[model samples]
Target: MSQKITWKDKLDFILFGWIINWAFPQYYRPKYHYTRYRKILLINVIPQKILGINRFVKWPVHFTSVIHSPEKITKGILCDPGDNPGIYIQANNGIIFGNNVGIGTGTKIISANHNKEEHSKHDTTSPIIIGNDVFIYANSVVLPGVKIGDNVVIGAGSIVTKDIPANSVAVGNPCKVIKHNPPHREKFTREEFNKNIPKQYHHYFDISSHE
Candidate 1:
């Protein structure tokens, strides 16, 4: 037998939809959309947003993760960087993330290196550029000014000190590329890359300004 929709059910649906629209502006057509709302209502969104915990992070994130200079960090559509616990992002210089990037639990991305001459000062450099469809696994550390290329998989517990080329699977303390898994991945210029990201995900613009 089919259950009839009551007025209360309609109200609940409308309220949930409103919350989702307000909170996640870039999440247009999120997968399993209704279920995501249920999870947000039950598990993730309340304490972090309402209790003033992780108040500066605009995205839906795990309460245990920390983000410094969130204004300097940029990400693509539906790319929730610190959704996993124990994740740390220090974007004092800047950190640019491409589309569909996944950051695992305990991962740390530090964008500014400390000066060799002065321990109190940070050395200036370009932003840590992470390319599209990249998966930085659990406990991995991406050091300052490192550029990870597109379609790359960084293994668990790896420390990335240098730039990694595209379509590679990298692992180890120094984070060397072991193999190029997808040889046929497409290449994109910096302009094209930036263009590929949705306007809602841009660091310069406020999420609410899109609508």
Candidate 2:
């Protein structure tokens, strides 16, 4: 014989329905949803159990600086998703970030530029793409149409005016490639790399002497 549906089961079903309605009311109404509240809580609250601090510490500040098309900004795993003073992301087109991307405090990424001749009009709006294992230091500005490649390090207070190639360290007011290969990874031997890295991360590094 099948088990009878108790009043407790009915109550659980009602609670579940209520939660869904409360979280996603956009399905029924045409109003601005408080979607970021859930995201903020997930970023701040859940991580504290394991990390002992908020994972996205600057999420509140970052959320306010996203001017246009905030939904188009996509970030990857293990990323510090925000800035301290705040980073301006005018994602009118889109901004795509790859895995292990760390954006430092006070970095601004402008995806749209105004016309030089006509100040009132927009010149062009394009996407900004930042690749995997990239670190953009504080107070740097990435202009519209800039594409930063994988395994790149951008120095502090630099202004990125054009596309940056992979596996380079760039710096200056208008950022320039100072080194072909970043010094940090080049200096380490396989044994040193394995020994220095945590046990969980040892699999990512090759055991051979030559990288």
lDDT of 1 by residue, 4-108 (tens): 656665565566756755665544333322244656654456756677666667677778888888889887764777878899999999999977678999999
Query: Which residue pairs in candidate 2 have backbone atoms (N, alpha carbon, C) closer than 3 angstroms, thus clashing?
Result: none
Per-candidate RMSD, Å = 8.1, 14.4
- Which runs in model 1 stand beyond 4 Å of their true positions? 1-15, 27-29, 33-35, 183-211
What's the distance in Å from true for residue 32, model 2?
33
lDDT of 2 by residue, 1-211 (tens): 3346556545543544344333322112111122333443344334432344422232333333333555667764334445244666677668877655777878888887878899887666668999867899998999988999878999999999999999899999889999975523422223421013334433334433113
Q: Which stretches of candidate 2 lie over 4 Å from their true place?
A: 1-67, 117-120, 182-211
What TM-score, computed on C-alpha atoms, does each candidate reach? 0.76, 0.56
Which pairs clash (backbone N, Cα, C closer than 3 Å) in model 1? Answer: none
Q: Rate the local accuracy (lDDT) of all candidates.
A: 0.74, 0.59
Poorest stretch of ten by lDDT in candidate 2 = 25-34
Best by TM-score: 1
